[model samples]
Target: MIIHVDAHIAYRFEEPTDFLLQMEAAAIPEQALSGPGLTTSASEHEAHISGEDAIGTRAWLRCEGDFTADYRITADIDRHLVDLDALNQLPPHQLPGATVPYLFDSRYCPADRFQSFVEAEFGELSGGARINAMVQWVADNFSYVPGSSNATTTALDSFVERQGICRDYAHVVCTMARASAIPARFVSCYAPDVTPQDFHAVAEVFLADKTGEPGSGAWHLVDATRMATAGEIVKIGVGRDAADVSFLTSYGIAQMQDKRISVTRG
Candidate 1:
């Protein structure tokens, strides 16, 4: 499926402030890009290509007054969503170096606190089954209340409150998978079917190689909200948790005056 994505963020600042932004759809192996994306800012500035992997290609700007970010991209997204029943976990040593960091606990997703519960619930399961179960556990149990969670909310907090937005759902799933010794990470995407269309967050777990390839496991995408369908999930970034991959990070204070994200299938 082909998709066109557009995102706009307008902000007001008290004093001069620096901001880091990520708003372009990734051109990955599965998602083929037709052309270069276009990014424009209200004020002139060069965006630095930063971050370790495909996680950042951002507009780093210092604006004293107001600013706006507009980014657009076109891609044929071939989202390779896995069968929840076929996934299996890989041994730690066999995991790629890049995947190792996801196995440990992070700020928003504190896996250590949930280790016991994860072991008890997923001890006998491995791979996709555990992942599917976790996704289902979150979807069926948690409420999708938009204003219920904030930047400081953690996986533990979401679990107790039983409600949050997409990122909160992602944190819980990542925490659970990490506790189960599965390498899991948070992903930000442009979801096609997401209501009131905005940026969306999803979860991914590393599944062990099943076709006689012990060290060749792959990442399987999962959405606890179950709003986005396959071929419509366009990823933008991947990291241990939201802290490492938020769409926007600011060095100074800025209040959002207006924001909207549009994702349309063509």
Candidate 2:
């Protein structure tokens, strides 16, 4: 599968502001950059860094006055698709060191608060089956309202309100999956079918590998909103929550003037 992406963002900064931006598709083994790859606006002062889990690239930029970024990329996706229901969940003791942290509570996804609820609602299932059910529950129970949530919204808030955007939906999925003893992390991605044509948020769950070796597992993408499937998602990065993978994070105030994103498949 080949996917093309184009995004433009314009913001006004009153004074010089430092920003961390992660807007490029990751070049993981499953996904290869093709064509001209990625092109972005160059800032006077900018440095590139490895994204969370070293899955992608991030840039630190210093800008003032009007700031704009134009990004374009083409990706060749060769993702390994699997049946979530057939995958087994690794116990905490069996999980890899890197995946262990995803099982704990995070700022946006407080897994601790969802333990009781997960136990009651998804007790009959285990591993990928449980996660599949939880994803469906979220999709069925929540409403997708664009402006219903803000940056401060957390999984608990979304759980109660049952309304929010992609990030909120992702937070809830991460929270519930972790509460069920599954190592789940948040993923920032792009997909061709996104309704609002914006950066997409999804969850990644670590499950036993197809090899079935003890303690062997791989991360798989799960989107409760059902907008895009794993094979079609172009992952940007992975983190415990959205805070670690925001497309743009400004140290100082930045007022948005215009933002446009387009993604298509060919």
Candidate 3:
């Protein structure tokens, strides 16, 4: 599979500002299953202007690879591994899942509120069945709604609202898994064939007891936002939460009044 992605972010400031700085993690890294063919980043910075000014930032990334790899699985849950190739390929700065202490933001701590929901849903099933059940539940109940929430939005907020984009959905799922004592993380990336959106979010749970191989269990992708199942390929940013791997940023006193993203795949 091969994919091309374009992301654009624009902000309008209320008054002239001296400086702006932003950290971007929109570029997807190559892994064992996929290869990054070509990738590029471009930004436009401006100085003090009139009452209203605008700043635009864009990123273009191209990737290509076979959809199936040596580690690809068909249906069985016991064949999962950590895909060490993928881990070794990542840059030092981006390696957080196995090394970082907290993938989610501190503000979102205290996950007691969401633990009960996970236990009730999967308590009767085996570990593998429990994960599958949770994934199915997310797919059945949520609907993707972009521009519905932002970084400050909490999992409780998402659960109550019942409507949000991928990030919100991923946060909700991450919270549930953590509450269940399952080590889970947030992932940000693009779904090339699904939609023309610049950014997307999914949750990866470490199903240690599901693989039947003892400590050999691997991370499984769960798309809470789109409610997608396993076997789908999507570029991803794995972290503790949305704050750990945000796709866009703004420096100075600018406000992002409007933003849009479109993605396409073949």
Off by over 4 Å in 1: 42-44
- Pairs of colliding residues, candidate 3: 103-240, 103-241, 104-240, 196-262, 196-263, 197-263
Measured by TM-score, the strongest candidate is 2
**Would you give me the overall lDDT of model 3?**
0.49
Tens-place lDDT per residue, model 3, 9-72, is 5455444333322222223223223233222222233332211011112322221211110111
Structural similarity to truth (TM-score) of each candidate: 0.94, 0.97, 0.62
Choose the strongest candidate by lDDT: 2
Q: Cα deviation of 220 in candidate 3 (Å)?
A: 1.6
Candidates' RMSD to native: 1.7, 1.1, 11.5
Against the reference, the lDDT scores of all candidates come to 0.82, 0.90, 0.49
Clashes of each: 4, 0, 6
Could you tell which candidate, 1 or 3, scores higher by TM-score?
A: 1
Q: Over the stretch 122-230, how does candidate 1's per-residue lDDT look in tens digits?
A: 6787778888888998999999998999999999999999999999999999999999888888988887788768899999888876674767888878889999865
TM-score preference between candidates 2 and 3, better one: 2
Candidate 2 has which clashing residue pairs, if any? none
